[model samples]
Target: MNSLEHLQEKVNYDKIFDCVQCGYCLPACPTYETMERETHSPRGRINLVKMVAEGKASVEDLRDPIEKCLGCMACTTVCPTNVQYGQILEGAKEVIEEHDVKSMAQKKVEAFLFESFFPSSNWMGTLGNATWLYQKSGIQKFVQTTYLTALAPMRLGRFERVLPDLPSPFERAFRKRRVLPDYKLRTTVAFFTGCVMDGIFFKTNQHTVELLRLAGAEVLLPKEQTCCGALHSHSGKGLSAKELAMTNIEAFDLEDVDYIVNNAGGCGAKMTEYPHLFEQGTEWHERAKEFAAKVRDISEVLVELDGLTFTTPVPRTVTYQPSCHMTNVQRVSEPPRMLLNNIPGLKVKELNRPDFCCGSAGIYNLVNYDESMEILDLKMIDVIERKPNAIITTNPGCLLQMKLGVERHGLEGEMEAMHLVDLLMEAEPAAK
Candidate 1:
């Protein structure tokens, strides 16, 4: 658990009562599927939460099960009662953070990431540049070849392998922030380049912007925008999340843009739920709703744009692993499929569990690597069986997680992982 506070005050007690315990969510939950225990299921987790809220069970009793949840919201897809389990889990996480105590190292790392690193673009740029240097300077090659990287902590060592090559300096990308279409701008759209998205998958974002431009939309990359605070909210730091939401609300001039476009499913989902971050009847709440109203996933925007067609053919048998946030929260399963199917020669195969969580629930894979890998291994069985040439995903975390799965199963020679935006860009005539 992130924190172990009383939890009663931190959560919406009434939401717990909304679950009908119909067992429909059990099969859909990755943890339940992995552990095959009721405690790990959504129904069991809700009941545990209700017990804590009612003071019948201590917070300690519910901590393990609650913390183990991937927060993927797959259960909600099957719920008959329309239970908002994701919100409930977020509330539970908040209470845990408030009450659960942390060790000094934990506290320091959390502070460094949440406070110092994420909120500032400069810090992220510096770190990204350092990572680039580590690779470009040949130090990374030396460490990997000498097996020195293996000496690092397990999670850290694994995370090192998953790190994508950093793009050129942020300044280079920022220089091309505002892009205009060749003929005429049908509409002007703001692109929400997320913190990690901009830092790590820089080329993907660049491709997204170019594709949007090709679709005749003027893309605006807001300079004042910061991290989406999804990680903070998931970790139970609601205040930090709210602060970041307000900062974003202030950053974007909503009236000037037709849509606030996001390529990352997780960031897009969180930004779309900005209204939930604020209180009812508050000014920020109203602002949040207005801001969220304009928010659209890149797929949502791309599929709707007229005259947007891929002239370059991509000849590969591709299967999509829809990011959990995209399918369940953003409610965007079809737009990507519709867009991919538009490609002339591309074969878009459907995975057995397209919406299944890749076990890359934000930082869940890092903190719970063993259990995460367990869930991922299950997903990989289906992925490997399907035997697609490339696996495409909409979010960075899912992209990395899928890559990790390919590496772990020694399927690198047979399959490759790619971001959807990158895939589309590869199928664009200009890219050819």
Candidate 2:
């Protein structure tokens, strides 16, 4: 069978037909706005899928547009017909992955990333440890000062400047597992410390646990939890994503917890859609539904508690960059804003296009370096207009991307990027 036949079998024809071609998603699309090409727009991509299904286009023709998409799902939010764009996009991605011929180097990298690195906690921990050593042993400084970083890829070298200070392996090993509320415990939740979130942004994960405790919840860290498989799914490794999802479902056996809480918006959104990774009526499908139903973003849980007391006055202006997945997929928007408003002395400034993507759709910045930077630069225009003291984000990817933006725009000391949970922790009473 040809690639078109595979697509015909894999693609959801019904979902593609849902697009009314009204172009409602054009303005909301970062690639559409940046590239100024219809092929990159949500409606255009949907049409391409429709064409591929109808044999008017080949699978190769659909590869570029699908790969270029951030998978942010912003288009779904504005669609008048409520097109299941994400499902269609994922299905097309899976078909492409199966049919497309990749170079040996690309295949090896994908194998390592999808089959080996991401799914292994040991590797992620090693990465954190290696990063810690690089920072602490003066190697990082020497490399930066000597311009050795220039020898690396352009995107990687630029990203090195904004990499978070990862916690040492020793620190991570001894991190707290159960955090009890100082006052009454309103609920119990199992915290899902994501792979990259825990490996790179370990401090933020720690802060999330503390913030949850402060919000009157008993927090339990499930050690068996693996990577959220978001990167895998977005990159078209659906089978790998499903394996990771099943591992997480078994790890987070959520029979007793009130919710399975997560700090990263991308991870949380993927976890909530676990059911989509499985077929209906299957045992894993029912299990995924149960797992997904319990998934909740940290902001959602915090807002519902309404028990946190802020003592320190932030006395700073900050603009929020909503995570596209958190907003469009998880359907969480107001809760994050509500929490920000509750902070004492903090002013929340709204960006011109507040819901726009920061071009950090998972690994987009690394893979499509030039395109991602273009989108980031476009997003920076709104950031420059706000000129807030800090840019706040819910997802780790958005936080890093905004940090790179702050650096690129020469606003380093004047501006900073922070995760929402960290900001909340900073506002908590000093006595802690």
Candidate 3:
């Protein structure tokens, strides 16, 4: 049986028809906001999906909306009737794949990794350990010398900056089950330690757990969880994404956990789409929805709880890049700002185009480097104008992309980027 047959989700009739064609989602959509094409906007894309389902639209007609969505799901949260557009959009993507097709090579490369790696943390850990070993053994230098990995979509320059070397901050792997010390009440939380955090940003992961523990929650880093498949879905490989969804469904076994805490904004946003990926009558499909219901970004977690108690002073004029996933995709505009304000010396300076997409729309910098860099270049100028000491965002993709933008513009650490969770964890504001 095919995957969609397993998802078995009924088309949400009431919410789907609620669109008034006002085109409000056009400005709200990053890609549509960037391209300004009707086909790319939310309403236009909704119409296109409707036409496709009703047999009035061709597979070729789908190319734009699918490409345009960024898989951001920015439209649904803002829609009055609460149309879960992400589910519909994902269904459309599966349909598109069923009819039209790409090259075997392209399909193979995508399927191999997404199917193989995304659902298993052990396998992912191996991949990370290999990369870490490569760098440690100077094999990365050899690859750079030979211009090998650079030939891939995400080049050495891009990968080098984003891939932080693990500094051996904490040599302890989080127990499959653990308890927190700061228990006002024992709240159970599942964690999505994404690929970067699991391997590269180990400190950030530790910080995330520390902050969560501080906030009174027992955190679980399930060995079964893998990549959130956010990048694959965003990159137009929904079939692979479905496999990942299935993998995580079985792996996580997240029952009894109150929420899946994701420190990274992009991963958190993607985790919320678990229901949309599977369409039919399988456990994985149900599990996907079950898991998604519990997902929360770190900022959202902090905001929902008591505000930050900054232990030390931040003392920096901070420029805020509302990560596309956190702000537009997930429609979480306020939580991050709220977290920042509680810090002792932090100044949350807003960027000129706060709602606009940063070039790093997750592997966007790799596949669509030109446009992505172009977007970053403009964002960099805004940062330069602000002359802030730090730029805080909630996604690894944004932090890396913006950090690169700072570097390309020759600013480097003079202007730094960090995850909002990491910043707040730093500000644990002990009772003085």
Model number with the top TM-score: 2
lDDT of 3 by residue, 161-278 (tens): 4466654312534333565645474467877788856766667877887777777677777766778888677545677667776767676774468888887878877877677676
How many angstroms is residue 382 displaced in model 2 relative to the true structure, after the best TM-score fit? Answer: 0.6
The residue-by-residue lDDT of candidate 1 on 18-132, one tens digit each, is: 8878898888899998988898999999998888887787767767787788999999999999998878888888767767743344345466577767777767777778888
Model 3 Cα shift for residue 335 (angstroms): 2.8
Model 2: runs farther than 4 Å from truth?
1-5, 101-112, 430-432
Order of candidate numbers by TM-score, starting with the best? 2, 1, 3
Judged by lDDT, which candidate is best? 2
Considering lDDT, which of the candidate structures 2 and 3 is the better prediction for this target? 2
Local lDDT at 187 for model 1: 82
TM-scores for all predictions: 0.94, 0.95, 0.80
How far does residue 218 in candidate 2 sit from its true spot (Å)? Answer: 1.0
lDDT score for residue 188 of model 2: 96
Candidate 2 clashes between residue pairs 3 or more apart in a chain or in different chains: none
Q: Candidate 1 local accuracy as lDDT?
A: 0.83
Off by over 4 Å in 3: 1-17, 50-57, 76-84, 103-116, 138-150, 153-157, 167-179, 182-186, 231-255, 277-293, 304-308, 328-331, 428-432
